[model samples]
Target: MDTCYGTPNRKIVLLTCNVDDMTGEEIGFAREIMMKSGAMEFYTIPVQMKKSRPGFEIRVVSKPGDADNMAALLLKHTSTFGVRMQELSAYALERRSQVIHTPFGDVRRVIGEGYGVLKEKLENDDVCAYAEKAGVDRKTAERQIYALLEAEKQER
Candidate 1:
């Protein structure tokens, strides 16, 4: 498939660690810090640790160069002593941004092209703003925006 934007050439690094000593609030703070520090994605999975004690497995995906920084952040913010690292080839879809007119106003969307298919995602802030302006529920505003996008797509 032809990319609407230029192809990306880079690798993705995944950093994972298990933390059993930190509280839930610390974990949440770590997640935010990771994102702000350039982590592409961050999440936690609930798990049972030694003696069946509750714990969490934190996962962070980032650019190859940012692995060490993210790992340090994980260790510094969380109680984890060590982090496991892995490198993987990353294939990203070409993406572009466009503003489309909707009943509420103009909204920006991120459109991605991959595998001969095009997909678009509305910005969350835009959806919320539209919902408030239109005095409609969030879902209703989202649906109206999607319908407008679909109609525009069909016109192309």
Candidate 2:
């Protein structure tokens, strides 16, 4: 089987640390901060720590050059004493966005193409807003937009 993505084009670092002390709101704030500070991706996974305590591991993907900065941010924002870093190779799709004009309005869609695979996804928020203004449900709006895209594709 052929893969949908091409070979890794970027070298990134994964920074992680386990913290059992912060509240949910605090973690959310830290996540926001990380995103704003140039973290490519930030997430948390629940885990059990020592003494049978529940904790979450903060995982951040960042550019290799920013690994130290990201780790410092994690240390300053979280209760963890230290952050771990691992370099990784990433394979990603090349993506672009287009606005399709329809009866409802202009709807934005993200197109990703790589290794002969093409995929498109409509923005949910745009669909929802248009649906409300057009007095239709989300599903109806989405269906109409997709149908229009399909017809355009067929014409081309």
Kindly list the per-residue Cα lDDT of model 1 for residues 1-156, writing each as its tens digit. 555344444589999999778888988999999999999999999999998888899999999989889999988998988999999876677789999888788899999887566788889999999999999999999999988878989999
Could you tell me the lDDT of residue 78 within candidate 1? Answer: 89
Query: What local distance difference test score does each model get?
Result: 0.89, 0.92
**Using alpha carbons, what is the TM-score of model 1?**
0.84
Winner by TM-score? 2
Q: Each prediction's TM-score against the native? A: 0.84, 0.87
Give the residue spans of candidate 1 off by over 4 A. Answer: 1-10, 102-105, 147-156
Instruction: Assess the local accuracy of residue 52 in candidate 1 as a C-alpha lDDT between 0 and 100.
Output: 83
**lDDT per residue (tens digit) for residues 86-132 in model 2:** 99997777899999998767899999888777889999999998898
